[model samples]
Target: PAGAGQDQTFRADDEPEHGDLIVTEAGVLKVLHTPGHASNHLCFLLVDQQLLFSGDHIMQGSTVVINPPDGDMKAYIESLYELLAESVRYIAPAHGFLMGHPEAVIDFLITHRLSREHKVARALGALTPVDLKALTAKAYDDVPAAIHGLAARSALAHLLKLEAEHRAFREGDLWHAIHES
Candidate 1:
């Protein structure tokens, strides 16, 4: 995504936040603040057609790369579930064609992410205090080596999520699994 230029500054009043109902001639475009793909990612819902303009939140037949800091596994999954609860018939992604099964897609994405998270946990449970690269190699062996660099970052995101839940701990760059007695 390209950064807005200096001239494209937006005022607070004009800014659309989460759950803001915006009325237009076409229809009401409900603003849903779906962060995690990026910190400020959003998806607009067309009230009339029940169409969702999913801007990079969910993609067509591809998993979103959950990079750390800006991209969060937890937040991304939450956003997916939130969108699942909504009445979306069609999904118009930023890339690719429109998707008819929005709910199934959203649910599948959630399941996929959770499954990856589980694999990360299992990998951690197998080893004691491991670096992100080793965990990624073990957990995401299904992924190609060329993209392991990217997968490492996504693994780090999972570790961070595990740490947030107190299921794991970080000691410097090495992460340790935290097993509750």
Candidate 2:
């Protein structure tokens, strides 16, 4: 039976390695590590049919957010590109049905992220001395208030990434655009 290791902040080294390849009655499946959603994220390739089992990476329904601290946005973007580079006609995701249009879904995801970055940029321009809570509120106002905390987390993820890239800076709980001098 499959198993998960002990809880650790990063990918634990103590985790067992379940062979690079798994051979079953179906076929020889190659394990592809697609870490983003979580450091443990994975995608499998069916050797016989060239089918890809996209577990939570390319869902058919709602787009999966690239949760940070553990899920790096940079890594997630790279992972998407890596998926596009692979040769596969069928995508069976963990959530929702099979993805009929993989390219379109990929494009949508990429564009969605870029759009969020733009929204952040616009938010930076319009306001001064905005805290994480306030900026996140405006940026993700469309989402229900109940889930605003999670939205704030995502927004903070963006802010953290932007800050690392020198595009933004944080003062206490607030984030301000670097150019506003």
The residue pairs found clashing in candidate 1 are none
Q: For candidate 2, list the clashing residue pairs, or say none.
A: none
User: What tens digits encode model 1's per-residue C-alpha lDDT throughout 123-162?
Assistant: 9989768988899999999989999999998999899889
* RMSD in Å for model 2: 4.6
RMSD of each candidate relative to the true structure: 2.4, 4.6
Top candidate on lDDT is 1
Model 1 error, position 71 (Å): 0.9
lDDT, each prediction: 0.89, 0.75
Tell me the tens digit of each residue's lDDT in model 2 across 1-181. 1227845455655542323778888998878777767777888888687788998877877877666777666566668878787677788989988776667678788788768877876786567468878887788777898987887767776777677778888788767887745
Model 2: residue 18 alpha-carbon error in angstroms: 12
Give per-model TM-scores. 0.92, 0.79
Candidate 2's clash total is 0
